[model samples]
Target: MHGARKAFACAVILATTALTSGQSFADEEVNVYSYRQPSLIQPLLDAFTAKTGIKTNVVFSDKGLGERIAAEGENSPADVMLTVDIGRLDTAKQLGIAEPIKSEVVAKDIPSQFRDVDGDWVGLTARARIIYASRERVDQTAITYEELADPKWKGRICTRSGQHDYTLGLIASMIVHHGEAETEKWLVGLRDNLARKPTGNDRAQVKSIYAGECDIALGNTYYMGQMETNDAEPEQKDWAASVRLIFPNAEDRGTHVNISGVILNKYAPNRDNAMKLIEFLTTPDAQEIYAETNFEYPLTPGVAIAERVKGWGELKPDDISLSEIAKYRKAASEMVDRVAFDDGPAS
Candidate 1:
């Protein structure tokens, strides 16, 4: 790891906030090993402590936290697993580290489509994989996942690495809904459409559109909010303004939706408090906080989104079960290489 990244990992692993306003859970704490940034989850943790007086300890990692927990086995101090994608959540479940939950509150508040059938994991928020179209260059207001493969769009699309987890989730969904053979053909078409070799984070794809390198791109919904509200990178605001988001496949199977979800560690030392925290995260109050702070769509009903996001229009999320989507990741990873999707267009 680079020096800065190593320092960041150490800081996130050791950092433990007490959330001590009225009462503290230093004694009744729940340990969370997360794949999400501490800043993104701190508000909810603080609210959980303030409401239930059960504090949380977090260890953040972009990778390897799961391996460490697996190595620790039943003696692990980890109480909860928090992450951003169904594939990761399902991986934890398959690794036998996740406990199957039996919470009525979670079942009632979270929709069945967003939670595992056996309750090993539950999605807290959802985002759509949609198109970011350049305002000045693209005339259309809508498109479809199928349409990306159309020859009309050749040399007009850009994306991050085809093998990135979010992109993998999308590719996995494509494989699930469309058979492997057809999906490969679609992959070839998409590959031939790239404005440049697939590169950068999702935000960089938007920047490419802003720079006129491509007319449209694939990105998650929350990133638009992040780009628009970013103060540190004020130019990202202009990047945000240059593109209009199009919800793909909206008139058909609906846009492919992904999630930020949570899990219960099977041997969580603080099982009761951990369950409390899980149930709390699924409730409207916490969902509202998540919606306002992170610009994510709440899985729970009746939670309104940010006004700016609301203006983008309603989401007709493809109701495909993400659990089913997780099964095709290996095939999707293979297809990316088979088609040389990251090498840009061959035309």
Candidate 2:
């Protein structure tokens, strides 16, 4: 499936490249390289074009966008890059393809923690890494990231692979709070509590809970909204119905949250229009459209959240800097391997 997706993405990129090969600095259009699907983001792009009178051109793929832009060097037509996960945003900064954002609008609208200290990237929306507890078997009203390791929950927890970006993000946050030594111990304990070998995406874990294969699983909050609204696969609605969303650590440090973010390409040919687009994206109207489209929390304060997202209860996001979490991501991946977390419960 991944290969198929990559192949299709390559075809799309080739087509977009053909269209953009002749772009010059004087062009009125802004070119975008994105990891987000066009369907998921087209509304915002359309809205931008409608408001600003500048055409938006997009090249999209599930991965390799930053590398592609870097490989294109100064001739790259990409003006803005859009993607999810702190890891990808950090990688764009590391690749030297990101131009630091200096917009006063961005600084005023986005919180400091969600924007890079170096100003290379800024988050647009947020999602909490939360627990999906079975409505039938779990009576608890709340849980913490630390409690997933308790002996009482032995053979009860389910999750995707620890190496996945979402899991790594949470583990990275744990390392930030508890240190590497303590975080490793927690991973070992959590490994022993798994119901089965780690597998599947966030939505799959919720399916497992609905099937009674596990009492709890870790997943992002927007997935609940997706599952609940899935008309194509009605079974997912039942899966969503079977679990209660628990924002981990909400009572203390708050839930571990990650972002979907954007970067300005260092080689942008349409820099002025790109800056306008970037600044426009930070406005409340664009943020509201983003939140409604993706079921994610708006990064701009006071933007309305999606109705389904609001029903999940209020989110008190962990106040820790995401850049700090990004720093420990490598260490967190190492801890996942050191503990052999995907090997499932120790028999």
Candidate 3:
């Protein structure tokens, strides 16, 4: 361990010890470094604490978390790291900051496709990348990822930056399915079909559909829930009302799916407690919290999906493992740049 990292870890230990002077479970805390928004995971953490009395200390941010932990080295106080997306989790493994989450409980609960082959990470929830098609303008009952490139849809699709992880994930899946040469050709076709320069987050794409700027868009399944239930921005309800969800390729290879996952930090100071929390997270009760609170599909086989999520449509996820898809991410990203996909449809 580096001296600076060791010293910092020691300081954190001492501070935690001081704070827990009178508490029964003071020494049972687990440190978390999360790339997910705190609000998204707070309920789960609270449930864990309530069940086991193991307190969670979290440092949350959306960017640079992997770099932060890598810089912290062997003495990193982070017991667990949480984030969404296979790309980020694979990046952490490549950075060498992960420990195998090798619990029989986890292996049995989470399906193989949702787990890293080396046990470096485990997915807790899954969301599909589906098409949001305008109810008024688009009459298609079904679509395929490949169909997006058909000349019939020219100047009729909207999307976020092709470089975004969500877009890249879908693109990566395309590479896995079609190989580099054909996937590259598909990217050109899809790029030319764009209604405008790929811009905005998934929600923004839905908003564009509402405005008649496009007839269809690519977005995650859960964004629909967030938009429909958005009381703070009630206008989002109308946006949600304007579109219908299409699970691409439901009759064939199925829609591309991604996960929100957790990893056991390589240098977990409280390894046992961290493992306990991880195990707790996979249990049916915790999985229920994930579904009800986040409107996501639980990884546990028997757990029910959120009713609102079910209302959107049945999701038949692509059977290819995320690890397989991740293998093609670099190629997918390069293809995006090579095709000048973000430049919008060539006029």
TM-score per candidate, in order? 0.94, 0.92, 0.94
RMSD of each: 3.8, 5.1, 3.3
Candidate 2 global CA lDDT score: 0.88
Over 4 Å off in model 3, which ranges? 1-23
Q: Report, for all candidates in order, the number of backbone clashes.
A: 0, 0, 0
Whole-model lDDT values for every prediction: 0.87, 0.88, 0.89
Query: Which residue window of length 10 is worst by lDDT in model 1?
Result: 1-10
CA displacement after TM-score superposition, residue 252 of candidate 1 (Å) = 1.5
**Candidate 3 worst ten-residue window by lDDT:** 12-21
Write model 1 residue lDDT over 155-267, tens digit each, in one string.
89999998988999999999888889999999899889888999999999999999999999999999999999999999999999999999998888889999999989888
What is residue 276's positional error in candidate 1, in angstroms? 0.4
Best to worst by lDDT, what's the order?
Answer: 3, 2, 1
Q: How far does residue 78 in candidate 1 sit from its true spot (Å)?
A: 0.6
Displacement of residue 169 (Cα, Å) in model 3 is 0.7
Model 1 compared with the native: what TM-score?
0.94
69-173 in candidate 3: lDDT tens per residue?
Answer: 899787688889899999999999899999999999999899999999999999999999999999998887899999999999999999999999999999999
Q: Tens digit of lDDT per residue, candidate 2, span 1-347?
A: 34523433455432211133344433367778889888888888878766666777777788899998888787777789999899999889999999999999999999999999999999998999999999999999888999988998999999999998889999999999999999988898899999999999999999999888999999999899889999999999999999999888889999999999999998887899899989998999999998888899999988888888989988999989999999999999988988899898888
